[model samples]
Target: MADLFFESIEGVKKPYIDSLQRLLKQLRSPFAEGDDVGIKLHWGERGNRSFLPPDYAREIAAWLMDRGAKPFVFDTTVLYSGGRRTAQDSLNTAASHGYTAEFLECPVIIADGMDGKNVVSIPAGYKHFPTVQVCNIFEQAKGFVIFSHVKGHMVSLFGGAIKNLSMGFASRAQKQRMHSDYHPVLNKKKCTRCGLCVEICSTKAATISEPEYPKYDLKKCIGCAQCIAMCPEMALQIFWNSDMTVFQEKLVETAAAVWKKIQNKSVVINALLNITEECDCLPGKNHIIGRDLGFISGYHPVAVDEESLKKTGTDIFEKAHPGIPWQRQFTYAREIGF
Candidate 1:
């Protein structure tokens, strides 16, 4: 029900600040001064240096503070073990990025608490999940805002507020449930008797055939996609046709969940920048696939994501990866009337 506002900036210059200030004005309408605002975001990955710069986020924080709204920037721990593993560790990542005690007006808090444990469940309404484990901070905050760095992802293909809510705000168990759909099922015939996948799997989702290559149990898998990423024979593949639609539906349902939970209490804005080949959670820096588009803000998360995708040019990333499709999310969102 919110109009998505967009500003396409070629560079992160004065234009970025102007656009962000404009967005804050738009989002402040239904609320008043002295509200506690929670800004949910992905604080870049461990080694993945492609996330939104702290300087930009700092400006947004300043804008909220200027309006008398107390703001806290936050992100939860990762479902997989790596960077931002604990609340303390996450704090360090934020500090290292200049979102320090000395810089930003308020301290960053991990929404899901330490080790991703803080959560409040919202019952589903004919959706894929029975309930969603949203972190307590997001649930209890007087107001909420999502600051997503829109980019290509291996799972959902494209991620914005909708994807962020579905995956980003979830507890590890909820994340495990969201990611449960697209696991790699190894083919015995394609097995080259190589030991790479088994050795490289972070979750031990696969077991070596010993006489042949490794075979994935699928049951033990977390669908982290590492084995497929490390596959030499290209034997491991997520069940695109069968499971992708399910993944999309879950994303839509989770978006609806986020919308319902926050209702009039939340807004989302996406920064279409550093358009990398992989997620910001990637361990290494990647080349930007697209130009740095600007910022777009909206109360309707689905609409914002839809518009953000259009701004990225209508090319599906699957043509480049041939491994995923982004339309699944939009299609499902439309079907669910988001």
Candidate 2:
């Protein structure tokens, strides 16, 4: 079992902050003095308020910096065309979300360069990808901390350390590969060419085929599934093959590869507040399914997520996104010695 740290949601005192400090201290110099450490966070989309507050990130950065480690907050640009599709836009969105250096006392770097094209490939030798296109900054960091907001997801069923590292750390191309197996298939029978898919497609993968028929270009699709969510007629369906389990396994494999690269110089902290039913990738407000449970941190990425799920008192994510087999991530992670 991994040595986990917890701060309960009890007492009048600010035990949450204390727990974070104690967790950092317990890590016991995961990075040497003057080492550059990466702090990964999901700067939530515009109109979305369920993300982990910048205050928590600031505290963590301050703690790390005070300990002589150089920490910088970062996140890769999203694959979809949204407020954070480009690096500049992402940084701007982060600032709008209060991730400014003035507030956090650290620079916010977009791991990938402008247009989300900057990438360095690493050989995972996994079942799906021979090499995963990890964002350049992740490979460049000496030590790293994944500051994840624990929430339910649409495809993977849960978003935590593994999801963060798998999709969060990858370049746009890598993200595409991971999502390739689950691309959207347009159902022509219920055709209603409202052009919602075309308007919402950030990659311009969806287009009208004239006479009210919507055509999708698979080669052009980055697989963000925005069309599926935007379709009013519910005409878009996932191309579910035998590769669904492989998708989760590939994510675990990529995460394992990243852990192997960083070795013992990494930590994962999960903020369990505002437990929403969807990932922060989507824009706008969402319904919260669970109350706050404070924060949990540990060196084991897989174990931290497992603990988070167990604390939910039920398979909340599985219930939220049925048939996703979310636990397969942990199983595969352990199988690869994560």
Candidate 3:
């Protein structure tokens, strides 16, 4: 079978749900009857407006059910303070976003458990990560559907299937590890002393006192970029502790490590609709950079992501997040045989 399949939402009234169904129909099921299939996705952060809707997820769950597989939607806890930092909070955020079990007809779960302690370290043998820790749900599901919303990111330049598989499946500690390469660099000229960065900082690395600009404690920072991403005045930027490409490599290493375990029984899907200037992890409205092209599905995360960038064009992400060595992700993936 071919490795890639695309279903365009253009020229259709019900583009999202209908086109996704067509794309799913073109792929062969990798699961046996009665298998537990996990549908991995990001159901938008608390106030995020650009995440893919639950209607599409419902379609995927229904498709899995029709094929005799029990499907459940899931996402892991994140490293930063937000709606998804803790498992219970993440589930509540998911439910608030209309991704409840009752609506999707399957349980919506947090893969890393309520306390974010359900994790397993897998051998990577890569240059960056000798071992990668991720959610301990690999043993629970016989098959997986990595449904990602392709969009621009502050660090990766673009978020797609590879990111969905990597950070999406990573443990909070692993997420912190991957994010440790950079810290927030404030631009005081643009800062409003709004204290948003301080408020959004998960580790209290960002602090502000009355009549003082925000101060970041590098020692306490986890490099999660929550402050950088949520800064209302665009005052914070990424300051790399090491070479910038190292961050990209770490991102690939984590994804590659997880992929090694799930590749055979998983499918990758990247939705090109709602292509935004920033990732759905951030709250508020993000600028749309592309028209609703459609959904691209494949057997490999790397391939699906590459095709998605090709369809959306790398120039779009580059313009949104300039000077990021995002190409290193692909090169590093190949270097490590990911």
Best prediction by TM-score: 3
Candidate 2 global Cα RMSD: 6.1
Q: Judged by lDDT, which candidate is best?
A: 3
Better of 2 and 3 by lDDT: 3
lDDT of 3 by residue, 1-338 (tens): 27799999877775368788899999889988999999999998889998888999999999999999999999998766679877888999999889999999999999988867688889999887788878999889998999999999988999998899899998866776677645778888989999978877879999999899999999998766667645656577544345668889999999998899988899888899889999988989999998889999999998899889889999989998999999998988888898
Write down the TM-score for model 2.
0.80
Cα-based TM-score, every candidate: 0.78, 0.80, 0.83
Q: Which residue runs of candidate 3 sit more than 4 Å off their true CA positions? A: 181-242
Q: Tell me how far candidate 1 lies from the true structure as C-alpha RMSD in angstroms.
A: 7.2
Badly placed stretches (over 4 Å) of model 1 are 10-15, 25-28, 181-242, 323-325
Lowest-lDDT window of 10 residues in candidate 1?
A: 233-242
Tell me which of candidates 1 and 2 scores higher on TM-score.
2
| CA error at residue 278 for candidate 1, angstroms | 0.9
Q: Look at candidate 2 and tell me the lDDT of residue 252.
A: 87
Local lDDT at 218 for model 1 = 68
* Evaluation by lDDT, superior candidate among 1 and 2: 2
lDDT (10s digit) by residue, model 2, range 17-119: 6656666676656888998999988989866778777888988898888889999999987656677767888888899989998999988888887755577
**For residues 1-338, could you state the per-residue lDDT of candidate 1 as single tens digits?**
44778776755474377767666666654445988888778877777688777766787778777878888888877655466756787788777766664576776888888745477787767467767766777545788777888888776777788878777777655665666654776776776867877786667877875565666776787665556544556566444434766777777787678777776877778988788877888777776788877888887787788788788864645544555645777776777666
